[model samples]
Target: MGHTLSSLYPVHRRAPVYRPKAFVVDDLATLHADIRSGGLATLVSVTGSGLVATHLPLLLRESDGPFGTLLGHISLANTQWKETDSGIEALAIFTGPETYVTPNWYAAKQETGRVVPTWNYAAIHAWGRPVFFQDADRLRDLVTQLTDKFEAGFPAPWRVADAPENYIESQLKAIVGFEMRITRIEGKRKFNQNRSAEDRQGVIRGLRELGAQGDTRKTEVADLMENIESEPPAGY
Candidate 1:
């Protein structure tokens, strides 16, 4: 896949000041790998008159060339694909665990009651052109890869081919395979990078005490924070 500014830049819109994020990812391969390992993402598309969104597992196929293709499928009964206008773009959003930060989580808040609640999270948005296909062979390949990835933990791993031939064929007919040539990718690691070191530590401790998905993500955020602290300042 070829890397170009036109393909990797985010579509900017002026609105919520809170929506602006630091665009940190500069490597396509690293960004693609993150999305691939994250496994699931929300695919959003706009039709002529409406919007359709579906949560699904996606596979990223790497190419030696400039761009990679995203592989996934949607139910045949879902008319969203057909409703979308030709050349319409789509967004696949992958969100990691996120947590709301209460003012109480900040040590600075104890001294000054000016703090407001915020959220800490990690997410990536991938934009691409959708390519839908109904070919039986392609469908089979997609199903096989999806099943294998999800079933690898089982004692007797499930295999699509293990099912009766007719059953498998019938099942494959019920879905449409699609490949998206990713044209843009934007990654945001909103883990309180804007906060002071002490305040970030306080947030991490608060999240850990909460012991939820957000807390689990805090562990990762903590690691990132450590790495940032250890690195030499840029242009030093």
Candidate 2:
């Protein structure tokens, strides 16, 4: 089941001048906190046959160890999981809001035509070995935890046990649960960090004009940058 693994694609050359560093989150507690807040992640795997990907709502759990495991369920009918070999490694991509940056947003556009359009986004990639769990109790626990996490804020939070036991049991059988013991984690917050102050301001203004999801995301990026700068130096 072991196969030669290829290195992940490097950050785009045109990306910011910042040196890309991989952040290994050895504390599963911290990792799970992020996963819980993020809600959804994209699962990707490589098989001898080809590549497969799926968007999933993940349930992260921590243990007293270097890395924690991720819990999720996929449709039983999905052949992708079945095709994966025993030792196959997979990647889970967690993405935050993203925005589009127009070329006109760069102040450089006024002096020269050197500027090009780019995207601003935040994401985390988790690489690990996946193990599928087909047990009924395990599946039920996963589902219950997932529901409780999402429904906690609601006045009438829905519970799996609220439904008939037979129905819940039957539904659980229709899907397969999976766990991934993460080995590597890469987090990138690709905002307009590399841009000049004027250029960054222009980009923010442009985003305000667009007023779409991208624009809102750009505003968030601006806020994050401001927060980072405003924070006092360590041990201050």
Candidate 3:
């Protein structure tokens, strides 16, 4: 399934004030891939008292539709699910590589003393209507899928069936399953896209040097920026 920029949430952040349109990623595939790669997301909701947030590993069912559904479970002991009102809009935020960018890294700072520190990062926001379920069968399937996904990279993957049937059932009862039908998605990649080529190169070099010294995140961000600078939009 494919999505258009029209399906994205309206921009109401400081991004429009400083980050140029070039940094706004309208590509749905990129957003989906980012969500998949960055499995953990922050699910936030508003309750009567105030707001709540939970961090969980979410599964994106791409086959579901253009804006795929998000699947995850919450501990029954954690009452967020109970507090969550069905049909209410919720936001799921998935983040990618992020690092502190020093103003000294920009060539413009040297040429015109007109640079400030900023953060370089990538992120996606997914808005959806949440639905909670307690069906044992559905919960079983969801747990199985989550287990399979997380364990796939292991040399010896563990299966849910490996556990005793009664034990698994008891464990399943401790959690509740949820599915959020995604309605709108927005992605932002702040990789100095608004800066000149020389400034970008300087930033990339500084990041790589910082990464080589010890900062792993800077290394990853540098690589992402390099790739974005080299590849065409369609290629990404």
For model 2, give the RMSD to the true fold. Answer: 5.6
- CA-only RMSD, every prediction: 6.4, 5.6, 6.6
Tell me the deviation in Å of residue 178 in model 2.
Answer: 1.2
Task: Give the C-alpha miss distance for residue 19 in model 3, angstroms.
Answer: 6.5
Q: How accurate locally, in lDDT, is each candidate?
A: 0.72, 0.71, 0.83
Error of 3 at 164 (Å): 3.1
- Name the Cα RMSD for model 3: 6.6
Can you write out model 2's per-residue Cα lDDT over 41-158, one digit (the tens) per residue? 8888766567789898997766724566778999999876787654556788887767777888889899787898888766667777688878998999899999998999999999
- Cα lDDT of model 1 by residue, 1-236, tens digit: 87433334333521111334342544676567667668678888766556689889988887822657788999999887677544556888887656678888887887777788887766778777788889999999999999998888899998997999999999889999889887766666666666677787888777666656555666665565555456544301
TM-score of each: 0.80, 0.77, 0.87
> Could you give the candidate ranking by TM-score, starting with the highest?
3, 1, 2
True-vs-predicted CA distance for residue 200, candidate 3, Å: 1.1
Candidate 1 residue 132 Cα shift, in angstroms, is 0.6
- Candidate 3 local Cα displacement, residue 133, angstroms: 0.5
